[model samples]
Target: MKPQRRLRLGMVGGGEGAFIGAVHRLAARMDDRYELVAGAFSSSLENCQRTGAALWLDPARCYASYQKMAAQEADGIDVVAIVTPNFLHAPVATAFLQAGIHVICDKPLCLNAQQASQLAAVVKQSQCQFILTHNYSAYPLIREARQRVLSGELGEIRFVEVEYLQDWMSELVEQTDNKQASWRGEPAKAGAGCIGDVGTHAWQLASFVSGMLPQSLSAELATVVAGRALDDDVRVTLRYANGARGRLWASQVASGHENSLRLRIYGSEASLEFQQENPNQLWIRPRNAPAYCLTRGSGVLSDEVRTMGRVPAGHPEGYLEGFGQIYREAADQIWAAIDGQPFSGSLLPGIDDGVAGMKFIDAVRHSSMADGKWVDFSAA
Candidate 1:
């Protein structure tokens, strides 16, 4: 198939001071698969205009609200990236999808199951693709780990552990001028603090690599920071359908840690570990053999997996590159669907993955509220 032009992109939120929005912009452009064309960058018109001017976007294309952007740019851009707060995720996505635009949304899907149901319905009725940015799963070694497990290298899975820790909110940062912290520390905006923020990422990573969603879970959710309105620390025990058990921990108040997302999977025959801070290596411990490390650039990776990186091994691609892989995959999938051609298969996260994350979150919240009782995933 002949190569096509870059997908024209638009964004909502991530205006002047947002962090993740800039990350999304960098990642989307890293693989040269997308070109941002417009955005409703902020609720404030001045901020939107300033952001658009900085990006060299047409001043007219920078709308004051997402609803206006969705209406006017509906046919102008190929896809819209949703980088708004958690509470706005569902509605923003719904508007774009209803306008027949594809979407690349940030994680935790939405605030709760009710929003999930509404967005799920919109996704089903739309013809456009939906890509959720579970960027961790798109890492090179992480993809290899998923392949290895799916190919039976792990035997029957027995244990899974995922812990995502950060210390950015160790104090009452929300009480200050921290823009990200202000909304994130609120239940209305962030939904569930560390659980919705990082716990879902951990859960998604476990399920992505291990290919197992728990049957039920017992959880303890706590607001580790004093005077905080939302839970910042969480521990959950997972029970898989095959009797395999798992543990997940996410905390924004974990001191001396920054983006310390890590995972370990133990099966009948061996165990594997991956740490985000390292990003370039995976450690495998076999039952009978000495454990060894798997690096990102190793020849062990398939041709397809290696394409995720812009440079060769030892160049050290981390968070940004992992996120770029998602954008690249979304571009490929969307182009394939448009061209009526069979293209490379994808493991891109979609609406179902988003819904699963929501349900897991709901169950965890329920279990924690019910005195750490086991809450079935089915009821979520």
Candidate 2:
């Protein structure tokens, strides 16, 4: 075995006050798998320069626009991390993929299903890896829950309930100076409201853990906040292909809830529940048996799940570490691809998952428009 090299990483669109951009940089740096060599941190030249100075990157490496960055830094960048708004995701990702750079993009894939398919095709042609940042799926307990479900400990899953609630949009914050809220509220920028922003996350987490995708769905989307164009609340019922049923509720107007993401799945013999707010514990209720908790770094966890944890049992690990796990696994796949080594099972969401999410978003919009009539969903 030999020492591995760090991937040269470039970023797009995480300037001052951008929350998720900092999260991506932190995740990429957490495991030392990638180095932030360059970035087009903002559309404005001044902001780009300021962000570059703040990150201590060489001033020459920061470009004013992603187009210039892609053209100029093509030879230097190994992976391009796109943390821009939803509308820019497709164009930025396509530009870098065409430049032969691998892409690690923030979620919802793109603004629409057409863009999703187009990017998927480009990735296949370029043979560059595309990793979608569905970060919740990387949690250690999520991995364990997935393992236990797959191992038949749950004995045929019957129902799934997933909700992602937040109070950030309870009022008309977009009318104020909230940068994050402003962009997400606009249909042109975000594509969809709560459904695209956090609903996709809830849907992805459920699919990741339950190993099932919805066959059909009926959705009700509402813009509860006055003067808002896009939806602020969403409720959907999912019918899986295997006869399993699920319900999902994603809302930014749920008062007093901040980043409350929780998932519960009930099977014939037992049930499992995990909450992002309390990420370390997984509650398991077995039929005719006492319910118990599965904690990260514990003896009962699978080897694969244990490896995702960084500390000893009972010590807490949260969002940053979970995000770091995805970064770690993505680095493995990218390195294997570059070295011509065989990559096994997927540890991170890929182009297919991105497309699937877009389809889910598309279906939700369609179903809501059709007065909550059932709409078929296929991840193909």
RMSD of 2: 1.2
Worst 10 residues of 2 by lDDT: 1-10
lDDT of 1 by residue, 1-380 (tens): 54568889999999999899999999988878889999999999999999999999999999998999999997899899999999999999999999989999999899998789889999999967999999999998999899888888878999999999999999999999999899997889988789999999999999999988899999999987789999999999999999999999999989999999999999899999999999999999999999989887888787767777778789788899888888888888988866777756679999999998998888988999999999989889
Put down candidate 2 lDDT per residue, 1-380, tens digits, no spaces: 33278999999999887889999999999989999999999988899999999999999999988998999888999899999999999999989999989899999899889889998999999899899999999999999999899989999889999999999998889888999888987889999899999999999999999999989999999999889989999999999887999999999999999999999999999999999999999999999999999888679888888888887888889899988988888888888877878888986898999999999988988899999989988732
Model 1: CA > 4 A from native: 342-344
TM-score of 1: 0.98
TM-score of each: 0.98, 0.98
lDDT of model number 1: 0.91
Error of 2 at 379 (Å): 8.8
